[model samples]
Target: MTERPSLKEMRAKALKNPEVKAEYDALASAFEMKRQMIALRKAAGLTQEEMAEKLGTKRSNISRLESMSASNSPSIATIENYARVLGYSLRVGFEPAAAR
Candidate 1:
């Protein structure tokens, strides 16, 4: 048996394909948001269950939110609540769309 390719290697290979690269670019914001949320929770020393308790939600709900798909949009109110509980604030902004 051969050793498996590393995640970085696999991702680099996947990114070479135009369609896959486009899809990844489209979902980049969602991935970054999830990363920041998880980091915030860790920095606050809170487990997902603890965070959910503070937010008055279930651990599974928190899990689902953290693992949300790019197509599944969360409400501003929901994001605001999460940020408030995490000792942060939510700020929304827009950028000019990329030229096709």
Candidate 2:
């Protein structure tokens, strides 16, 4: 049997490509945002279906929002709705861009 490369190893290899590294860095914050949203929903003891019902949408929609693709950005109003149902609020801010 062969051992598979670990994620850390794979990431290091991928990041060696300048274009891949740039894309990965661009997506880091988006990935973190989804993780935080999922964490908040879990912390509130809400399943996708339960949260969807509260938000008056389909469970699949909530799933899609939580697993958004690079091309599928959620609207501010939609995000606000999610936060409202989750007993949370949404805040937006900007940070300095990371050095290349």
Query: Number of the top candidate by lDDT?
Result: 2
Q: Worst 10-residue stretch by lDDT in candidate 2?
A: 67-76
Clashes of each: 0, 0
lDDT per residue (tens digit) for residues 1-100 in model 2: 9999999999899999999989988888889889989999999999999999999999989999999474589999998888888888999999998776
After superposing candidate 1, which stretches have Cα over 4 Å from the reference? 69-71
Per-candidate TM-score against the hidden true structure: 0.90, 0.89
| Deviation in Å, model 2, residue 61 alpha carbon | 0.5
lDDT of 2 at 18: 96
Model 1's lDDT to the true fold? 0.88
CA-lDDT, candidates in order: 0.88, 0.90
Cα error, candidate 2, residue 6 (Å): 1.3
Q: Which ten residues in a row have the lowest lDDT in candidate 1?
A: 65-74
